[model samples]
Target: MTVFLRLSAAAVTAVASCQAVGALAQEVEPSDRATTDRLEEIVVTAARRPTTFQDADVSVTVLSRIQLEQARIRDIRQLDGVVPNVQFNESGQLGSTFISIRGIESNPFIVNRAAVYIDGIPFRELSNAVLNQVESIEVLRGPQATLYGANSESGLIVINTRAPTDHAVYEGRFTTTGFQGGTSAMIDGFAAGPLSETVSGSLAFKASTSDSFLRNIQPGRPAGEIRENFLQGRLRWKPSDALTINATAYVLDTNAPGVFDQEYLPLDVDLYNRTYAETYNGGRTIGQFTYVNDAPKKTEELETVAGLSATYQLAYGTLDAAVSYRKLSTDARGLDVELTALPTSAGQDYKVKTFWNGELRFASPADRPFNYIVGVSHYRQDDRRFLATFVGPGELDDFVPAPVQLAEARDWGAFFSANWTPTALPALTISGGLRYDRAHRSADQTAGSLDLGPAGIFVYRDASLSGDFDAVLPRASALYRVSSQFSLYANAAKGYVPGGFNLTAAQADLADQVLRYDSETLWSREAGFKWRSSNGRFRLAGAAFYIRADHWQEIQVATDEEGRLISSDYIGTDASIDSKGFEIEATAEPIDRLTLTANLGYTDARYRNLQLDADTNVSGERVKLVPEYDGYLAARYQASNGLYVRAEAALTGEESLESRGEAIQPATQTIGLQLGYEGPRWSARLFVDNLTNVRRSSGLAFRNFAFGNDGNWYAPIARSRQVGFELGVRL
Candidate 1:
């Protein structure tokens, strides 16, 4: 029995477009607030170990390192909502980092509902690193699959960088940033000390040059620029003290300008903040190349992570182990855009990628109440796709073409989790875990190829698909320490994602055939509560959830039985689905000199009978940005001499841009401002971002034309709304 239907009633309104830090802990965190202790400070890998934060029961959000040096955040999408429902999308790469937590997001070849870790490892691609050595950022909303497995089923972002610190001392800091019109320069610095009497390590570097904000009217030309660079180094060797070793190396060179996301406006014309110069002068009238990518797509990435963890000393406690390695590469230039869909020629497309990963883990030791963790993971990927279309003038055509997709993938997994607190029931704590995932993929399609001259006949075909997949993910949680500040929790979970193969060449491949998409699952349930107030400051938290998916995937609109109109691939899978949410985060200092932070979220996405095969219609569409009122609030003030001030406000309300079909973004609000001065080593500042240029829209790309009448002259829209200025220094 299959079902899925709903496309009437004015089509459910449209609009598409869609951090952690810790320390100085004492103890007495019912999750946060005027609690007494001084540094019990807390954390729980979102239900993995070293618990705190009201003993945790899911529903999480944290950011420290002085709140990322007071919001001067650089990557990690500005830590988005400070938490709550987590929302972030950056089709622009490097700046936004494509992520939508709480609301779960897949796409980028789907397969991650929310899972990204660093420190405890497991970072296959949450948009690949780049946060300049962060020290904290945790957001474990719901469905963390017992402990962040099974793609997390839509909740998890554990990033904890910045290690080797306890003294033997010397530190460093430096920063420079500016932006307007297109975008401009940026620099970063870092340093650490001590190599004797045990060991030490640290070093960082960042570089950027921006200038691309779409405004190419196709003429003599001017406007379009991009540049980026990064370098990193780290080493920690303990020789003894049980066992410890860490080595890290990083290098990223993305020449930027893959067209900076957009600048070639031809979709009729809307001149939005106009300005383009991403370079691509090959003269002559051309209609479109699938939105245009006239070459200029560059990428370079290098990563090496080495680890050796140990804590031995088990008289019944203390034991840990870890191992890791990863490598990746990307070379892009997609514009093979259907010869501008006959705009008379000109629309480019390209693809190239290489990936690798490995992991290992073990754990046990939490002062005993029974604790455990185990793991094994592996992944490999390779891709090469290219097709250029343009048929006219000075006559030169890849003579006509068809897709030439290629792929190589290998995945493996074995995970475990356990936690049981007994000893007179310290308030009840029982957690569980399970993971056994296996995936193997393959593909080959050289369907067509040619290099014809004198512009004429063209033909190519061979779309391929080779596959294999297996899955099993399960998790559980429970907590009821209803005192010492309050607590109550419950959880259950299951998740899966594994499907591959799709590489095509077009000449209408005989009407159409070349679309692959399958692999999706979800099952979740949750509950939560927490409060704090002992003397540390003030804190509060909340959570609630209910989700189910017996197969849920997207990327729709497939056709071709002579009816033509076949290009966008990836089909749908259905069955009643659900998503409920609630979050009310808080932090306060009231007087000591003013300091406060706030976050709020209310999410709900639906479509309970969109099954397939057995037509079961159910309308009431609303699930995409999963917005039912999101939130953020901040205020900082420190006084003991030098003056300082800070204020922030954020609100994201309005959502419903589902895919597998259609929907785009509309509805927004954003604001920020900062002023500061502090002296100890050195400090100075001034900042203003967005401020008002709130111009927002993000259905995150999904519009193409050329079928029934030139599809609006080829549509493309993705980035706009940026204001920047920053200065920082500390030593």
Candidate 2:
């Protein structure tokens, strides 16, 4: 309640201030609706067909190129507080990002509830969601299984890159950010033009490096640093008036620091690090046996993606076909502080993932009273992982060589959807879709470990497991056009995450007990409305949604008879969860030169019935990482002389970190400010993010020990306040 009050007050103050400033401004010509109407103008392809935002019955959020710049959203992590009912726990590890939508949450290290698509290519992992050379991002907030299939239980995010054009254009941008701990710089640019009468091409590049944000307490060891390079190219060919082809390729390389913060540092030493030194929840202090160890360690990553797409304009319909291939390799080394206060030694993990996918789709003409689309997609992914651990204090003595863990998966699906409008009442439209998915997965694992109780006991194990599953999902929606400017929509959808074999079962004594986990399923019902003014000066969108999920897959940690701790990454089934939320987004132009936008979201997510073990039944606990209330408010003003300024603020409500309600995270608030000037060919902007430097933990976990002076709480610190300037030029 208090968090809501604070947010209300902040929003009221901002609105009042903007109104006061607008009352004294001189009258000017009405501004271009193009800039502010970007949301209504956006056309999305989530349904395998091009549909205007207003016509799409699903709940979605669209961010255009102009909006991305105004918000300074560079990566997925920065998307926090910018959207409604959307949150993330970014562990900064390769392929480890937990995303939640309306309380549907998944483990970061195990699987994701939502799927991500780049230019119509599905990515099994979140490592490729990086923001660069992009055009637009569309986030569907409800079940989309009819078209997307698995991993769409929560929803899906579709990112479309800019296509090559016949017109010649070149654009470049440079930015540098400075803070108390470190500084970073980046250069991004792109060039697009026609190579021949029937051919066009575009190229984009980005390079950046940053000093370590952590101060190494260990002598002679370097601080954590980051370096990255990204490059992509696209070529398009128009063979005839009926056919078009495009090919794209990209390469990404990044090196970053591994495992962070052994223990919280003192306030004087690190302003960002917080501690529970004198708390009563756990008996812990900063001056324990464990100390900071910011050594010169890093995780190297490389990713390459290539794709080809062709569209043929048939006499009766349009045919689209695409194929893509992606490869990812990562090598990491870090200290293992999970078990003991003293360093157990260094640990390393090397992994490689390869993915191949193809899609074919045909859509009827949109101008007809009845429209339909039919599509089929096939994808296969293979992974190989190798791990190593070196143990010792001063010198490396004991060495554990882990066997390779391998997994191969293949999925194929076919979907058909149609839209019908009655001739008598053209304002009423009915839509429905159905999809059938079949998946085959297999795992090969060989695990090796070193025991360290009384006498050193080494163990080696091997296991193989395979599984096959099939699902049929459906979707239905209705839209009523009340008027030219207002529309009401209601939809019901179902989605699921496919089942797979557990590779970790090889390490334990009982392999069959944990060989595989079943798929989780979700059903959602939502109602929403869209409204806009004739002049595009005002826009409002809101939605109310309810979701029921079954067979939630969860990891459980328990102890064996010998007091040996064991963790099963994917074990749970038959548990249930329920979530309901409401979101409202509105934008108004109080004056011709000023635009004010505000969004409010409320979510109540809780587990229905869950059995942690034979003796414990935890029901009605809040879902992990889903906040009750989240919202943002912003104001932007532009002058006829090409001058502009903007300010925005976001508020996040309190949330529980664990399913058992053992840990909780407090509410957080952040603000941003920007000032800029634009000319014909040049533009410059100065921006400040996290203006108040709020320190809040995005996630929480348990330490290795039961209880001790060292706090048993594991929380990753987020970035602090940053101020920077960006310059851009176009030719």
Candidate 3:
């Protein structure tokens, strides 16, 4: 609460200061004005319809192409500081990214709380390479289930790739980066042209390889390394002025050697040294970004996506239809549970063989007093997985692997949204939406066992589970246009995540109690204002939101009566969480040839009526992995000679790593600088990131007293300082 108040006060002061400066600028002569006088108007499709940013009632942030380039945001993980009230937890893997929005968290083992859409294809688990060649990125904060359906209890992210050009165009970019521990190079190319009188096509590709910054300190062990390749093609056909069709296909492949996605460390350095340093690490202290593991490490992944869409102009409205298919396969090994050279490891193989979705929608003309949109969507997926755990010796070859797990899921939804303006109140607009969604899930697990020479034989039981879940989501909002330069809005919405069965449970008796978990629901209320100067030199937007969630789902590591580890699965608890936050964003051209931008966010999220287990009650505890406050500031200057310089800083507040607040990550601040020159057909840039060499962990996992360790805390540390040069050419 204190943080929120402080942020609110600061935002108000900043807005007032900017307004005063704008007024003063008007007193100057016309010739002394900035080169770019007015801010560009941005249109977004977050509500399933095109609407101006100032007119839309939702709280959204849009990153334009220029902004993306200035911020050097090439991957999703790089957006952590630039986007307000959002964080990307990097697990140091190719496709394992966890996102947190407004204090709602997602992990690798569970479905995402927020949903992401890339070129009309839904992604529950996002990949870093998907951000390449994007036209714009839109982030909508709050419950978006009314239009996006399930798994959007937190928010939504929409990414639109650049479309095919009507005229021939070619572009290429090359970059080389040098960091503390390694060097890497990447090349990106794009080509587009007209395929025929009514058709155009575009293709883009990216290839990169690098040595991991995290080193392996053990003897004769190889250091981590990564190689990635991506390719995408897009086709657009305009049969007539009233009809259009589009198709897209993409593939991504990655290979990582000697890299364990997640690495465990000791909470107490002294205890760790006394326990295993002499025997495992040659009597050396375990430090950050260094580990000792003798197991063979490798991870391979392949992903493919294809999508098609069509739009037709109707007499009174427009109709749109889209279908998409996606598949992902992963094979991984070399996960050392003990963080030692003791030969205890794990491996997994999983394939999402069939995943597809389709949607149809109609939108009425937006130039009328009353407009509406109606849509229906269907989604389905099937997957198979195999897991192995090796305890004492030789890896997968000598161990008995776990059973093959098969799962299937299906979902369907229908939604309607409308906006109305009363004749008596022309300045006030009211909007409302409703959606009905249903989901079905089924899973089957085959029995298996593990044999430990002197220990014992562990046996697994076969199980089959099926279930159905449903929800009715609704939203309402009102916007009042005070004038052409200012507006105020308020909205409320509901969001939910469907229930699912836990097939990992081993014991039949435990299955009855932990076989299924209930759905989680959230209600959010938000109010905000947007303002722009009459001269259009400054813009500011601020919002305050409150959210309440019920039936929080958490992963529980089950243990036997004697404190022996049994299994882990998702479980619903009699707990809830309340989050309150505020965000402020502003942009201004205070003087000629210069631009300034700043944003700040604060979230006060805490648990209520919470119980982790029979013996632990964590009421009033702050949510894990949620920062209390985050902020960004940047300034850029452009000279008449086409040379530009930009400086930026990002700040992140302290956060707890676990629900019990046993481990806390301190606050961190980083600085970045860029100098570039742009010409008619060429560009070059020199950039430096993390100028102060700040070292911290991007994410943390708490695992205590497991795998015969006193305290095991796993983390993925942030990269050190980096210097890079980039060159680009267009023809």
Please identify which of the two predictions, 1 or 3, would achieve the higher lDDT against the true structure: 3
Q: Which stretches of candidate 2 lie over 4 Å from their true place?
A: 1-40, 93-95, 214-216, 257-291, 294-296, 339-341, 394-399, 450-460, 505-511, 559-565, 705-711
Q: How would you encode candidate 3's per-residue C-alpha lDDT over 325-386 as one tens digit per residue?
A: 99988777666655676665444434445689999999999888899999999999898877
Q: CA lDDT, every prediction?
A: 0.56, 0.71, 0.77
Per-model TM values vs. the true structure: 0.33, 0.88, 0.91
How many collisions between residues are there in candidate 3? 0
Number of clashing residue pairs, candidate 2: 0
lDDT of 1 by residue, 521-594 (tens): 77778788888777757778787777777556654443333323344344455444677777788877767657
Per-residue lDDT of model 2, residues 466-558, tens digit only: 889888899999999998888999999888877777655222464365567788788999999988888767888899999998877766545
Candidate 3: regions farther than 4 A off = 1-37, 265-275, 393-400, 450-459, 505-511, 559-565, 704-709
Query: What number of clashing residue pairs does each candidate have, in the order they appear?
Result: 85, 0, 0
**lDDT-sorted candidate list, best first:** 3, 2, 1
Task: Give candidate 1's total backbone clashes.
Answer: 85
Model 3, position 456, has a per-residue lDDT of 31
The positional error of residue 149 in candidate 3, measured at the CA in angstroms, is 1.4
Question: TM-score of the candidate numbered 3?
Answer: 0.91
**Pairing residues by index, what is the TM-score of model 1?**
0.33
